[model samples]
Target chain A: MKFHWFHLMSYPDLPDDFREKNRSVWVDVDPNLYDPEVGHHAYNEYLDELEYAGQMGFDGICVNEHHQNAYGLMPSPNLMAATLARRTTEPKIVVMGNSVALYNPPTRIAEEFAMLDCLSGGRLVAGFPVGTPMDTIFSYGEPPATLREKYREGVELILRAWQEPEPFAFNGKYTQLRYVNPWPRPLQKPHPPVWIPGGGASVETWRWCGEHNFLYAYLSYFGYEAAVKSMDAYWETMAEMNIDQNPYRAGFLQFVGVADTDAEAEKLYAEPALYFYNRCLHWYPGFTSAAGYMSVESMRKGIKSQVAQAGSALSSIGQVTSTETSWKEIVDKSYVICGSPDTVVERLEDLATRLNVGHLMLLLQFGNMGKELTMQNTHRFATEVMPKLRDKFGDHVDHWWPSSGLANEKTAQPAPINSELGGNSQPTPD
Target chain B: MEELNLPSGRSAKVFTFGDNTAVGDNIKGDNARQDNDNYNDSDNCNDNNLPLVFFHSAGGVDENDPFLNQLAASFKIYAPVAPGFSDLEELDDLVSVSDVALHYDDILEALNIAEFHLAGHSFGGMFAAEYAAHYPKKVKTLSLIAPVGLWNDDYPVLDIFATPPLELGQYLFGDPDSELAQAFSSLASDISGNEEEIVESIIQTVQGLVTAGKYMMPIPDRGLNRRLYRVIAPTLLIWGERDQIVSANYAKDFAKLLRDSKELIVKGGGHMITLEFTDKLVEAITKHAK
Candidate 1:
């Protein structure tokens, strides 16, 4: 399995009563709670943690975009990817990524992704996600009724801009372009690998991803057991489409916290885990499944919710919003796999095998987690947890991975972790 | 259930209530020869044959609506459910008010109705105004009850979808505890024993809002301010004085744009002025249309 160290960079200082007292952590979230001084210290520390993951030999370092949300600080993830490209080496600069629909022209995404690929020497995985309702409908003011269409058109334009050799004139219902020419074509031939990170509830998304051969990365907050229903839906869709059961065609994100022993890991992560489950996921009730957010086709299949709760991550099976879930409930459900290396390895292997998850995006840095703890967690997972699961999916070829090291003999074999790239600086908390 | 095959290659179900037509008959199917006309005659409407194409609000329309039942006694009531309101289909075709106006035209033409009195309430009020703006000459008279095609930064249209379902009655009814409002609230309780029916009702209610949201969510204005001058039909704009959904102040906005229009503000009424003051509303519509 391929390991990508993902950071949500949740703002650290929401009050304990944030869930009860505040309107939301997302759109219309009270801005006064955010302290730029704290953010300055936090951002640098966060970037340093990612670079540490890079030097620790993670297959990828990931960042994503969210707007006007205290849940995630990065409004523009490309800026973060650019910084990672210059600061780190070896790891694929995976941006899980720009919300394609929000851009006016959407060619901006093509230009920026291309720039990242060239700058990172072709080690970039371009992720196209239709952003959450909070980000797209509420914050960006895109009409919920037409947001999906806008997203589809935006992705098409970006793809054509990258793949089409000549500058072409394009006219669409949402977007009309006179000359679609992006300068400085990407270093990766035919463009970088396109991974569609989705909620996996929308049938249209499943069919679209399956037909396009794009990796449908299911980012569920509710862990693997809760994920069974959604991930199974994707695999079922693939079967219906008569495609191969290659695990490489899909990716899954899970929040993971690791330490020396199971009890110790629980104790260490409990506070941050509570903060994340309670604060960062505190979506206002009505906007979670905003009106018309799910397409008619998905609703017809009796999918009562929108895109597998990636954005609307309301607990359907559990029914309790994450805010009400205790640390014990959190772990029992594997919301975050808090345990020693052996415990994490066993559960992860079971999950990855059951769900056929070849690409694992582990959220190591979460809400209110101090940089010291995040670095320690990243260190433990990389040194202990990842190696055990590496060969589990070795039989399946990852066609969705970036074609970087294939062309260059120098980059073919990645170098081991070294202090030069900012590894081993922090003393292991254990 | 007067199913119409629209010229746009779309088929629709319309509830026709009046003098000549039977309620819920297959108007254009194999039974067409057996029944030359099958509009619903639920109220035993007087044989005036003066049709009133009644448009409903985001709350949805029913064949048995007391207000429509009253109006049917005076004119043939053709109540067509908006495309996606309950059926949850053709939603994309009803994205904008202009699209909605054209869709209504096709529905009317398919039913072979012309130069009829047009009236609507709330979201339907907005739709009626839009259709009137499109084909001014086709409408003999128009009545809009709490229409929502105009927006004021000061008195904004209340977002029904944004408000929690439990607290919605305060914005919609003049008195939440009134007999009619109580009956409407307890309508859900009428099916409390059947969980499956309750779930279906919730789904349909939400579906109605989602469909209505296409034209009304975020903001209800759809360029009707620039185009209301095209409506030449004599018009009546009504509002509850205490309406929280669309304030009575909007009546002035609509009146200013309409060359031949008047306004009515019912005392102590909210957005659902039609349901709250049905007798007053029916009398006003009949007098104005006459």
Candidate 2:
């Protein structure tokens, strides 16, 4: 299986009382709280984490789009991808990606993405997300009724701009461009592989990905245990549509932290995990779904949270927004895989085998995890865990990964420390 | 009351009442034609009562509106449901208030109505204003109650869609604890104990907010402020003194732009004045239309 290292770059150091006092951490989250000095350090440090992941030999590294939110510091993920492009060579530069409808011309994305692809020597996995309601309808102020249509139009415009042999005059409802041509086109043939990371609610998005032969990356803070039914439903959908169950056709994002022992790992990762679930994901209920954001047909299929007929919701499968949830509760709900490498490997393999997804996007850094711990997790997982799961679906061809810059590179780096050498001992926190 | 088939695959649900049908002269439903082949000036003057083109509130077209029922006693009421409120797909054909104005014009033309008095409340008020501005001469008089279009920095509009369902009464009614307000609050949990009906009512309530949000969200101003100068009708700007959604002070914002306009603040009333103060609304509309 191909592993992509990802980071949300959630702003660290939110006051402990932030959740208690605020209605949300997004949209209208207090700007006064965002210290520019901290951001300067964060941008550099976050890029360092992506760079570190690349040097450690992960197949890919990712960044995504979110606006006016403290959790995701990337408003323009392409910039981060560009910096990664200049700084790293081996890893596929994944910007998963810009919110298409939010852009006025949207061709801006085509230009920027092509620049990244050219810089990375055709190592780009372009992602087109419909975007969260908070980013699209509420923040960008696109009418919810027309957001999907506008996105569909924007994607078509962008694809055509990249691949169309000559300049073409395009007249779209939301966007109109007389001359549709982008300079410095992508080095990848036709365009980069498209991956759609979604919240796993909209049936239309699922269908769109299947019909278009694009990789649908189902991203949820609630981990694989919560995703069993939905992933099964996705495969069910693929089967019903007469599409092949080529595991690489989909992706799953999971949070991971690793240490020597399961108990030690739990102690190290608990604070950040709690902060993530409590502060980073704290959102106002009102901002969840804008009006007409989901079509009537989708609503009948039980839109976003409702699609989980887990039957009265015994656990917090979909009720993630309810705050004050404890770290133990989050772990109990299988929201994170924070344990020793053995435990993580066991659970992840189970997840892959059960969910039938080959592309595993591992979110190594989440919430307010400091550089030291994030590096520790990154090092431990890369050296210990990834090798075991590297070849789970190794034989399958990843049709969605851009093929230009990805051969003759060994993705697995087994740690050099010998078994008898005490494994380059570092002092433990007694 | 019947369905009026309009152009662009639109099926407009129109409620007509009172014996004195002014336009199309009492003709109903599919039999009506928009071609204007049998047009007459007498349609506007039926027993000295001008045809009342009533635009219902953002809550969607209710044939049994208390305010409309009272107004029907003295005038013919042509109440048509706005697009999107019924079928969400209809919103695709509308991007701005200008599109809605043209769509409403089609509805009236389909009913074979040439001239009438226009009145709208809440979201409907915003559309009524836009429609009047688009075709100024067709409307004899205009009435807008708690309309949302202008933004007042000091008294900014609140996010109605964000307000929790049960607590919505506080934003809508002057006396949230009153009988009618209580009924609206308990609409989802009515004593009838019919699950389907209760669920349907709850869905309808959300649909109202969603449809209204299409034009009203992220500030309601869809260039209606720029075109308010075009309306030539004698207009009345109505508001509830205690209206929490849009304050009574907003009446000045509309009245100042209207060519010949008057303002009225109903005592102890709120945003849904037609529901809470039906008599006051009926009396004010009756005196203003003729």
Candidate 3:
């Protein structure tokens, strides 16, 4: 199994006074945490960690963009991708991407992304996110209700700019251009693959992704059990869309902290995990707002409700009670993977087996976690967890672009639709 | 400056002196004012010896806009037909900004100016920025006058000056009636007598906005900052100090990020500084060319 490690690279220098009072920077962390000097250092260190992940045999390294927030400092992930382009060889550089609607003339996105793709010699996976209400409204000044429509327009324009070999004209309700052409075309044929990273059912989004043959990654911040439900919903939608249920095509993101032993890893990860749950999620409540973005189906549905709908618009904020989650609770629910090499492997294996997830995204740099601890976790993961997982999964995939050698086929998991369980079972039986 | 009604059914008004070099004339004459009928638009410039192409302000009356005329004299300017504004055949077939780019490219090729400097004022400036980014190689320089593309949350708001300045300003900025107000305003500012004749001129030229306005494209999201690196040519970003539509800070920031670029803020002017400070603008253009 090819593992992907994504570091949010959060710069954690909350003001001394703010932290002393134990004020929640959790969901809406202190924006002041991003000091330019400290940010510069932390960003470089994060780049090192990503490059290290690549060097350590991870298949891909992921970086994303966020604006005017302290939870994540990368306002332009392409800047980081460009740096990585020069810093490392191999490993696909995934820019979870610029929010489409947030971009004025989406062609600019097309051009810059093309430049990075060419610069990287074709190792680019372009991600287009509809964006959260906070980014679309507060950050970009976009009308909330129009976010999805604007996103659609932006995507249509950008794709045309990239794919159309000949010059073209694009006129939309919001953007009008006489010429839609881009230079420094991507190295990949017909442009790099497009992936949409979203949260919740987003049934329409998943079906569209499946129809378009793009990868769908559910941004799982709520942990493994929740992730299983999201992935399950995606698979069901894929089947409904009459698309093939390819396990490798499905991916999940998790916050992972590993060390020499389970006890050590757990103790070290406790504060960071709590910090993420309390600060990152609590501080950014704007991610969940009554923006007209929610589809009719989503408007009526409750959290964990069975009605499949397009991207979840409202967060069931009051669902989870209490401000803090203990390490014991995290361990019991397997919401996170914090343990020794053996323990990490066991937890991941369980998740992969349960969800039949083809791609695993490990978020190692998160919360107020410092650079030192991040590197330590990376080293341990590279040396320990990766090897054992590879051994169990047998790394024999048809395409291994960046790294070398072939994965052994013996460790491959059975197809989700196979008759191994029962020939007469429901096609997408959970 | 020379004005000639060509024998080939085309009229030419050429300006040359300080920083301007341009030749242009209105197409519909003084009868098509407020004429809702769309006309076919086309332009041809063959300034083989010229190194610059500049587009003048709203009226298409190149001679009267002294600031733009002065800039034209300092540089090789080609303020050609802006579709319906000039005598060229107009088409209602236009739909997108990219389409305008394609058509504009034809104009450039027809001009025999393979690669040249480019500058525009007010609405025209917005076109220059987009054109430069699209055809970076064909452009050697870019000059804008109170350009309207960047509208950040903190964008400066321009104060209107006419008797009904606010209403006039709204029209000038984007109202369909902007053409009528622009013509009357331009002629009234230049000469006082014969309001009837001036009104006629306004009507004939006012309709030009339909095509002229086509050149302005919606500014992209963080587009200016990201595309700065893509433009390889030296750039000159200009804005009027008294101009209210776009802030000087925008120009300052744009200048800072635009590699090999310079900002010139003209004093004693508003968004219409392209008309108010023609002399100084021409001087700045001439200096930058050197």
Candidate 4:
């Protein structure tokens, strides 16, 4: 029943004085008035918001890693997480985390994650991802075929670094480690719980989560209906493997918004979501191409798109990124959830009950949405939808996540919110 | 990255294709690999053969038979299955011609066949044109047969009735009732040959298409002019004199756009001329490959 909110803090008009024109060499930016000073200011403002959310009764706060992209400014979410860890208390600090394969020596991830855990008193949810081809190949120079293997080895090394009591030697095809010892063991014994964010129904990912009993979050950008379908696909595999159907073990993510009325929320939220996907997701050429023939079944059933049969044509040049399929289109397909508190609550409860899932990850900051609107949506949901769900669940499953018995046991309580009516309910920075 | 679920419920992330043979590589399967692998390399040759990767057009049929193969006798060939149409793992994330083109870059890198000659048919030609445009250095020479990306507004309109099942059989093979003609007409002209071979191949391919119907769809009109002019590779433009799908008039249009290129006209032959008239087609390919 514990609710974790993940924010990407997509900014449209960052304060002019704080923008950095040459902050990142890898990605293109607006040349005029792009000041490094402005970038840091905006970064502080974003962190302040996440901290506020933690205080506003959210169980956990999440940040992610992306490089050379304005869709999200955090090329290194670990930096942001470390900052939050120092500032916040109680709430689990989940770094939706690093793209393990993107780093040359993924030990960098282990070190940064360990630092954040020590700084935050051991609240961390470590997430490992095989970055999108655009990020992995174009930005990081990691080849696609080697991506799965790289992620695999990086996970092995980081986990061992946390749990292995003695120094050890490790060797692998892509990564080799001789010292094999990491400092600042996590606050959670053995390690913090592992959360794997899957773009879609990655069968190997589901199996891995099911086998290890790690929390599997289907990190989605499409919408809710697709999320359910994807989760169902994962559940089917989980069932085949006879993995427990406990709610906390499985999680789904959505771009959520709540307002006085469904229409108001939809109108306010639609444009930003569209902008994030259509413009910010663009990749420089030579990223997605594959040499071998991927089976048709994989495309339709697993890869999940109508463009699958176009073969490599879908990834070819002269192809403009398609316009965002509308909110109505998404609702019909269950891609998003934007409505009044009652409507949102009903939808969420139904979705969770239908899928029989335990954990739900809510992405409140999307695309270039402003902080004002994002805060409004978060406050309303926290005040309305969350309390009901929190009270509804019985003792059958642990309502509070990051419980002490968990391997990565971090504090489950969120930062305390302002209780004096609606007057000044802002969260204090950690 | 999640680990794989083992049958025993313990997680393991290891899965491999492990040299598994494709089911359709038989007579019915089109065996696209064999089409690229079957070269007329009868003359004295070294192991260091020039690789010819054939890009199938929209129909997903291999066009490197007879003609492309006869030319392949002088070099190596590697024809790839159109993504999602072969025995390999399917890609669900791709859509639009640009995405396909980018993904092809991944394929080439994965195979470690750095530099090679690329030739595509129809829509495949559009993909090849995109590849040449993006990775001109990787391309040794480009050959496009009835390429579809270049548009000629004045081209003749498609008459669906003229090539319905019965009429298409009569138009291609002089036998409306012949299953071989029907099979060949359903595929491209070049692939239609002996009764047994054509029918079997068509049956399996059509089934694959039907099964993949959920994922297959027409390409949208994405902006191409911004890129078509940037291809700098030496190119060969092969088109049917009477091409209807992309129009014969576009031949000069494409030729004009390509800075370093040549054109070959398959007189009276259709878009699938590489298979229909193999000898003359082989001559054109040899002239360029040399």
Sort the predicted structures by TM-score, highest score first. 2, 1, 4, 3
Candidate 1 local lDDT, A60-109, one digit each (tens): 99999999989899999999999899888689999999898899889999
Q: What fraction of the real A-B contacts shows up in model 3?
A: 0.00
Provide the lDDT at A65 for model 1: 94
Which ranges in model 2 have alpha carbons more than 4 Å from their true place?
A303-321, A405-430, B20-23, B26-47, B188-203
* Candidate 1 clashes between residue pairs 3 or more apart in a chain or in different chains: B1-B24, B16-B40, B21-B39
Candidate 1: regions farther than 4 A off: A303-323, A405-430, B20-49, B86-95, B179-203
RMSD each, Å: 7.3, 7.3, 18.9, 14.4
Candidate rank order under DockQ? 2, 1, 4, 3
lDDT score at residue A170, model 3, on the 0-100 scale: 81
Q: Give the Å error, residue A121, model 1.
A: 1.3
Q: State in Å the error of residue A417, model 1.
A: 22
> Going through the candidates in order, what fraction of the true interface contacts does each contain?
0.25, 0.19, 0.00, 0.00
**Residue-by-residue lDDT tens digits, candidate 2, A233-293:** 8888888899999899989999988877767867888888889988988888667665467
Best by DockQ: 2
lDDT of 4 by residue, A1-430 (tens): 7788887755455333322223221244445634577677678878877988888888889988776555577878888887787677867888887899877677787777877776777678888877654456445644343456568788888888888889988887678878877776666667778888777646677777777777787777676665667777787888899875667776777767787786787688887766655455443332332221122233334321322322322221111233435667755555668787888888888877776666677877776677788788789888998988885444557522443333454544434455554446666789
lDDT of 4 at B282: 69
Best by the TM-score measure = 2
Candidate 2 clashing pairs? none
